[model samples]
Target chain A: MTRHRAAATLMPLMSLALAGLLVVAVLDLPPQSGLAEPVAGAMDRAGVDHPVTAVLLNFRAYDTFLELAVLLLAVLAVWSLGRRDPIPARPVQGPVLHGTLRHLIPVAVVTGGYLVWVGSSDSGGAFQGGAVLGAAGVMLMLSRPRELPMLPAPLQRLGLALGVCVFLAVGTAGLLAGHGFMGYPPDWAYPLILGIELVAALSIALTLVLLFLGGRHGH
Target chain B: MATDPVNLQIYLACGALLFVMGVHALVVRRHLLLKILAINIMGSGIFMVLLGVAAGGEGGVDPVPHALVITGIVVALSATAVALVLMLRVKAATGLARLPRSGPED
Candidate 1:
């Protein structure tokens, strides 16, 4: 008991010390001009009108590509663990949930699409759109008392792999054209970024739903 | 940037404090779920710091950091999903939601 109490106290003390150091660090940080100016200067060359979108899809495509891979890797890891256990009990569905979902899913789908389309010039983007679509998928899953049907195995694999595959293909095409890897030709940047975002959003939505489902549906 | 310096300072302080609290919870809590949540809190703190700094710069908010934080958020979500599944597997295998305590003191 004494040891436990001692550990508890020691842990808080350590945390406090760490907190103080972090505050000091924050206070000590040097202020300077930021990359905003540089990004703005490059905006004409960048495909997207929104600075954040340009940075994400053009200036730093590599990061976004790797992020997609990470999402895919996560689902792969989950699938490897085991088949998911079924929900313990099914609560009888109320008409309210059914009615809500009936109205909600179509709205979510349209909103998600609009977000992806507007992302090049506004706050909405692939990730935000993907999240909305994913939430709709989760709602659909919850609404169904029975096991939700899985996509055919091949199609499922293709959907899961779509984002990375399309991204790599585009990058490879860029490489072949001598714009360097992940680079789009000056005129082609807008369309390519938009296309990639669309596919990526679709893949992200699928990945999130699969993650929520918690394991692979056994073949 | 047009952002207020005082507000920036407050945000940075809050971020640092949040990170500290997350560390504290991670250490003191034994539930695997709480540990996962604490780690997420830590990530949120880092995001807050990034945004605060992004706003502190002159001219405009830095788009690079905004992009980085978005990437970070997606990565964090992916990580959390995997961690939750792993926790469920652990619970099934060990019959405990908390990890087995192991220490010289124990």
Candidate 2:
């Protein structure tokens, strides 16, 4: 009881001290009006075209490609590292939670698909959707831990390669048409952007799910 | 209210807070999963900071930062997967969820 009291007393004091620091930090900020003009000028130079798509495919296509490569490497690392390890048999935890997740998994999967589909125009996208799908896999694992399927090595490799493959294909096609890498012909911009984003979202989602599943050899 | 640079400042501050918290988590937590969460939080902070920096003018938020953030988000998840896999392997080997401690040698 004494220990509980001591912790309770200390928590509030710590919180109050933190709150005071936050207030001071906020108060010290410079006034807002002085920063407007320079920022606006920078924005003007950036060109107000389809900024999001342009940023992804043109301005920083190199970064996007590398990012895809990183996911591929991660999948490979996990696969190689886990190859020699013995697989632990997962024990069944509870029936109630398992039953609940059985229904929840499909819902999560459908919602994730919807998010990826609508990502181009809406607040959600492939990343969010993929995370949701990964979470559903997590839920399934937690409930029916032993039932999770092992991912085949070839399929896992394919999943990791998918993102990079799509990216390079589009980029090379663009180059063949007399544009630089990833520089789509003006008429083909929207279609190509949608295609790339869709593939990226799916590949990324699967890679993440595989990662969460601990790169096991089955599922 | 009309667009203001102050909003950008607020976003920057939020990002800073997220980063500091992530650093603190990295220092204090031994659990690998929690560490992954901390890393994600830090990535989120970076994204927020970039977006805030780009939101300079009256026009819509800069697409460059948005694109960068999206890429960052993907990379973060990729890193998270690799980390999680490592953690799982460690768990399988040691039967513990926490990272191995460095011994006092030197």
Candidate 3:
């Protein structure tokens, strides 16, 4: 009891001291507004108008590739930790839930696609699109309990691996062509990025739902 | 695309406060879930700082940091999933949400 109490006091003091240092450092940051123009040439090389998408898909594609790999690693770790959990007992669904499910899935799919497309020109991207799709899956899981058992195991695995496999394949091809890993040729950049993003969104959505499902192969 | 520097500073300050709060929570909380939550909050604070710093140019916010933050958010989500599963495993083994006593010190 005494140890806990002592920690409570000390932790706040340490936090405050750290915060003071952070404030001093943050205060020294000279604010620069507008798009940092330095990266414009790199953006042009990326072949898309949206600077953020260009950065993610071209300027620094390797980071994103590794990020996908890391996500897969996390899921693998989770799976290794235990046997498949039995699906939870079905909740009694109200009429309202049924109605919402009827409408929500279609909206989520359309919006997810829209986000994927918008990512190239404006805001929204694979992650956001995938989130919407994952929500739809979760809602479907909730509304249709029987489908849980019916979810095929192999399909889920494919969804989980699709993003990384596709990305790596493209990157390796770039290397084979002497363009280096994750390099987008001046002409191939647009199609390659959009195609990769579409697959990535699918994989991301599946991985999220798989995370929710938990255990090996989400069985 | 020019933005008020004062507003930007406010966001950075908020991020700093969040970081400290997350640190405090991580230290003070014994529950595994709360610790994971504090870590997530800490990640959010860092993302906010990145955004604040990157938003300083006239051509809209720099896309590199924006992409980085998006990637960070996804990575964080997976990490939380792993943490939650670990917590579940720990609970199953020990029947406790908080850590078990390491020895007879108590």
Candidate 4:
């Protein structure tokens, strides 16, 4: 009873302390007057409509490209980790869960595609979509681990390389168009963004799924 | 009080809450999956803050931060994938779900 009383008292005190700290922190923040106005104004002056996509594929194309490379490296790391290991048998779990997951997989795949498509103008995007699709693979592993497909080494490499290849190819195309590396030829900007995003979505989803599988074959 | 900065305050507060929750999760959760989720939450918190700052106490939101967050989401997933693989291997090797501990052993 005494310990319970103490715990009850401590909880409120902790909560109060946290609230006070939050209030102080909020108060300390700069007044929201003149933060990103200049940058927004500049974007307006430059006539860079669809600034979000423009910034993604044009202004910061190199960063996005490197990000794809980073994902590829991650896939490679997972592959190396599981190398030379014999595939293990799947764990035995219940049937209801398995059936439910099977149903969910197709829904997830469709949702992922939708996200990639709508990402052009909306909050959703390739990464979000890719992650959702990757979750489907996780579901497969969890529900029917025995049925997991073996990702051949070559295909694994291809999955990892797909995004980077698309990004680099587009960058190269831009260079040939006299726009220099990673520059978007003004007319092709939307199409290139769409293409890069689509490929990146697939590559990212595959890499994530493979990671969950530990790059191993199911025995 | 009607300067109408409520939206800004709310966003900033949400960001702070997310950051704090993420920190708590990182410290307390032993599961690798939970840890990765915590990290993503932290990234999202930072993203919110960036967007809030970019909002600039005005109507138009900044596109730069939106773009940055998009890139960040991808990077976060990449890291998550690698971490999940490592966790699976660890689970396979140790038959334990949590991280390995360093201690004086027999």
Tell how far residue B65 is off in model 3, in angstroms: 1.2
Best by lDDT: 1
Worst 10 residues of 3 chain B by lDDT: B97-106
* Tens digits of lDDT, candidate 3, B1-106: 6558888889888888888888888867778899999999999999998898887666777777888899899899989999999998888889887766442221
**Tens digit of lDDT per residue, candidate 2, span A122-183?**
56655677678778866665455466455666776776687789889988997899978866
Clashing pairs in 4: none
Candidate 1 lDDT, A105-217, residue by residue in tens: 99999999999999999998999999999999877776673455678878878998999999999988999999889999989999999999999999999999888887845
Fraction of true contacts retained by every candidate, in order, equals 0.79, 0.34, 0.68, 0.44
Q: Give the lDDT of residue A64 in candidate 3.
A: 93
Clashes of each: 2, 5, 11, 0
Give lDDT tens digits, candidate 4, residues A161-191. 8889999999998899898898876667767
Question: Candidate 2 — which residues are off by over 4 angstroms?
Answer: A1-50, A83-103, A137-151, B1-8, B25-38, B87-106
Docking class of 4: acceptable
Q: DockQ of candidate 3?
A: 0.56
- How do all the candidates rank in terms of TM-score, highest first? 1, 3, 4, 2
Clashing pairs in 1: B1-B58, B1-B59
Q: For this target, which candidate reaches the highest TM-score against the unseen true structure?
A: 1
Give lDDT tens digits, candidate 2, residues B52-74. 65575354565566777887777
lDDT of 1: 0.88
